[model samples]
Target: MHILLVGAGLSGAVIARKLAEAGHRATVIDGRDHIAGNCHTERDPETGVMVHRYGPHIFHTDDEEVWDYVQGFMRFMPYKNRVKTTSQGAVYSLPVNLHTINQFYGRTMRPDEARAFIEEQADTSIEEPQTFEEQALRFVGPDLYEAFFKGYTEKQWGCSPTELPASILKRLPLRFNYDDNYFSHRFQGMPEHGYTEMVSRILDHPGIEVHLQTWFDPAAAGEYDHVFYSGALDGYFGYALGRLGYRTLDFKRFTYDGDYQGCAVMNYGDRQVPYTRITEHKHFSPWETHEKSTCYEEYSRACTPEDEPFYPIRLVDEKALLADYIARAEETEGVTFVGRLGTYRYLDMDRTIREALDTVAAYLSDTAQGRAPRAFYQPPMG
Candidate 1:
């Protein structure tokens, strides 16, 4: 079957590659001039170093399949992400670990001592924590909450932590040990040459044809046997159910000599700082040493129609709209919505590739049995 894949991101590119390998013709179209959408990387002409055009994407995943799948294209150097956060004129390690606790309060404590101390600090009155602030206070106490999360959370979400869900803070683990490794993943690294080359290698198939700088017309799906849409889900439906909420990023780039931040990602966990985090590109590639480095001070805001959407703000109201759009999509024909934008959720590249692989495998399984392909393929969750 002939497949029309919209967007040249990881999900679409992986699916297209899989489809072409199964002897299906796939025509990939992206509105952008280059491929590797959000993870787009290119060599800086002046500095001769690889630059992540969007923002720093540290590839960290525990899934061995996802890890091995990515490595098939390009080499990845082992890079542990140890993020430092600054707040209230003090710098601390991330994940609210033992070192962070001891340094902030100016007292040394063992693992058991730290655990007991935090438990005592926790607000016992708040039995059922709902908001982010309440949750943080209940777990990490008032002083740490005010310094680390309160202002930073408010800045990132553009709202007080009281209005936000507790689940946001729950995602971040509070460690007992002094393990500064941000992620507890088995495989963690960035591409040796950068993300662009890896993605380009993925699409290097005889049956695959990639058309960049082209807007995909869903109305012209009749021209092809099937469509794999990875654009905005609401946009695909012409916003008949109203636009879904999304938070997009604005990056301010600057070049610096030698190391700027000491680490790849540094979170400014203070309201005084306009942006949430600063990314130093040179730190991402630990294997290659460069004199000059690039940094991006990232600012997040409500996504406009014209802005490049980074994360879906799937609030209560937006989730309802997404439900409606998803229902509409199920009723529609000849299209499969995959990946972050298409599904209207914030997905790391690993999960995106994993899901895309699942979609292609399901389609191929149906073909093997001589059955009709399903309308969509993705694991819907609560």
Candidate 2:
């Protein structure tokens, strides 16, 4: 089998490696001159720091198989992500923990009391909360919502909380305890080398051929027996239905004398500020040291055709558009959509790779008994 993989990100790289190991001729291509798509990392010539070009990509996953599978390419260093926030001319621990709750309200409440007090504080009205604002108010009340969530949500999503769905705030936890480890994932760490090096090693097999700065063509892909596309799902159809909505980021970087915030990430939760967060790239790879540091102020806006899409909006309007695209994709042939952009969902790096590997396994299983490859491998939500 000859496998053609579009997009040299984790999904493309991992799936290509798997296909090649199965004695298939796999060809991988990307628009960028690098291997890892959004997780691209390179050495800063000036500071000698490993820079995460897209943003701070902390490799965190609870899946033991994913953790062990990724370790084959490069050594990983154990790193915990401690995030802070700047709001109301003051700093606070992120994920809205106990200290933040107490300081914000000027009350000394223990873990259990805090949990109980927050329940008391939450609005009892609006039995079924639909919007983000109503959901937050119902969960943690107005003061805490305004101080921590309102500005940040507005800035990050470019919409008032009322317009957004309650499901958006559901994953963002409000903890009673002081544990500030951002993710509850069991395995969290960074590659000893940068992501580019790791991915480069992953795709450096004899049977694999990598083509950089290549554009997609369905006619061109016909040369291969099977196609695995990790590009935009809507893009595969040439946006015949319409462009599914997406949010993209523009990064502004600055080189400072020393450590800037003493933390890797800081979210500027103020609608007054145009950008959402500032990431210190040097801090992401704490295993290495540099006298100077580089940080990126991230600004998010509607994704343009020219820019790389970072996040899918996945609002009602976008979902409607995506439905039409999925139908068009099902009618098409020889291509399977896999990964975050392919499925039109916001996915972490680990999740994307895991899905890609699973997709290949599903395809191979179907082939062993002699069945045609499906247009997609992901199960639709009921």
Candidate 3:
């Protein structure tokens, strides 16, 4: 079988490798000049630091199989995402942990004491929270919400908390203990070489042919037996329905002679600050050291047609438009949507790889049974 992969990112690379191993010829194409998509990394010629070109991508996953799969391609160095935020003229730990609570209030309280004290501050009157603001007020009270989440959320999403859904805040951890690690996953690390090199190795199979800076026309789908698209879902249809909402980031790069914030990521929680967060790239690869450091001041805004989409904004209006696009995708044939952009959802790297592997397995199984594979492995909507 000849398979056409639309994007050369993690999803397309994983799927292409798996299919190539099964003795199928795979051709991978990407509009961008790079192969790794948003996770592309390169060395800073001046600083000799491994820079995450898109942003800081920390690989964290509890799935043992996924962790081992990545290790087969490149060595992973142990890394933990300890994050901090600047708010109200003071720096504090993230996720509103016990230490953050004590520091923000200027009081030393044990876990139990802090828990009880926060309960008193919470607005119990709202039994069920519907919006982001209501969820924060119900969980951590008004002061913490204003200090940590309000301004940051507003800037990141370009909307007031009252307009966003409560589910947005549900995934965040509000720890009673002092552990400040952002993610709770068991396996967390960085690829020793870089994401581009890791993905380059993944696509090294003899059966796979990669063409960079290639624009795949939908009319060319008939050239291959099957098409696996990792590009934008709406883009596959030429946005005939409507463009889905997304939040794209603008990274302003700056170089510092010494360590800037003494951490990997420093988020500014005050809305007065134009940018949302500043990331020190050298800190991402702590095993390697250099006298000079490179950083990015990240700014988020509504995505336009010319900008590269980052975070999907699945608000009510966008959901309605997405439903129309999904219907159009189902009506179309011979092409299967895969990855975050294809499904129009925000997904971590581990989940993207897992889904790609599962998608290929299902595709192969269906072909063996003489049945057409599904348009989607799983519904995009949860």
Candidate 1 lDDT tens digits, 216-265: 77789889988888999888978887999887889998888888889888
Candidate 1 lDDT score at position 215:
95
What's the lDDT for all of these models? 0.88, 0.87, 0.95
With candidate 1 superimposed using the best TM-score fit, by how many Å does residue 221's alpha carbon deviate from the native?
0.8
TM-score of the candidate numbered 2?
0.97
Worst 10 residues of 1 by lDDT: 373-382
**Candidate 2 residue-wise lDDT, 1-382, digit = tens:** 9889998999899989988998989999988887899999999888888999988889999888889889988889989998999988888988899988998888999999999999898998968999999999998998888888999888778889999999889888788988898988999999999899999999999989999999788778789888888899888878877888888899998899999998999988877988888999888888788999988999988888898899788888988788788887888788888877778888888888788889989888888889989988984221
Q: Which stretches of candidate 2 lie over 4 Å from their true place?
A: 380-382
Q: For model 3, what is the alpha-carbon lDDT of residue 371?
A: 91
Best by lDDT: 3
lDDT of 3 by residue, 63-180 (tens): 9999999999999999999999999999999878999999999999999999999999999998999999999999999999999999999999999999999999999999889999
Error of 1 at 4 (Å): 0.8
Tell me which of candidates 1 and 3 scores higher on lDDT: 3
- RMSD values for the candidates in order, in angstroms, are 1.3, 1.2, 0.7
